[model samples]
Target: MGVCLVLIVLAWNVVRLWSTTAAVVMSVVAAVLPPIAAVVANWGEDH
Candidate 1:
């Protein structure tokens, strides 16, 4: 997802310099988002 990619890029480039822990947290959250989006997107689908 676009949001996930943005978070990762920002975490790597910007956040990491400020705090590696925070960047790792952001990356973890970003990693979780796409699967959540997929589940939500298909939540009520017939197939």
Candidate 2:
């Protein structure tokens, strides 16, 4: 996520009008949720 943000910032700096904000947002969500989902799935498997 930090890398994505850095890329976005670099692109914005280079192009000054890049439209990858959604990609950055999606990358952040994609970074955070899957492991949480996996843990929830594992916990539920025992119950």
Candidate 3:
């Protein structure tokens, strides 16, 4: 849910900016961070 919300905000900014390099960078971060975060956040739970 949080990831979805962040994606929506990033998408809105990307649309608003429409041609900026930062939007591209943010889009990449939005694509990559969630899964990495999920792993890191859960890394010790199983033990």
Best by lDDT, which number? 1
State every prediction's TM-score relative to the real structure. 0.88, 0.41, 0.53
Better of 1 and 3 by lDDT: 1
Model 3: worst 10 consecutive residues (lDDT sum): 14-23
* Candidate 1: tens digits of C-alpha lDDT, residues 1-47: 88999999999999999999999999999999989989999999986
When summed lDDT is taken over every stretch of 10 residues in candidate 1, the lowest stretch is 38-47
Cα displacement (angstroms), candidate 3, residue 8, comes to: 5.1
Question: Could you tell me the lDDT of residue 35 within candidate 1?
Answer: 90
> Compared with the true structure, what per-residue lDDT tens digits does model 2 show for residues 1-47?
45556655565565445556755665566566667777877996765
Name the 10 consecutive residues with the lowest summed lDDT in model 2. 10-19
Backbone clashes in each candidate structure, one number apiece?
0, 0, 0
What is the Cα-based TM-score of model 3?
Answer: 0.53
Candidate 3: give the clashing pairs.
none
Please give the ranking of all candidate structures by TM-score, highest first, separated by commas: 1, 3, 2
lDDT of each: 0.96, 0.61, 0.71
Q: Give me the overall lDDT of model 1.
A: 0.96
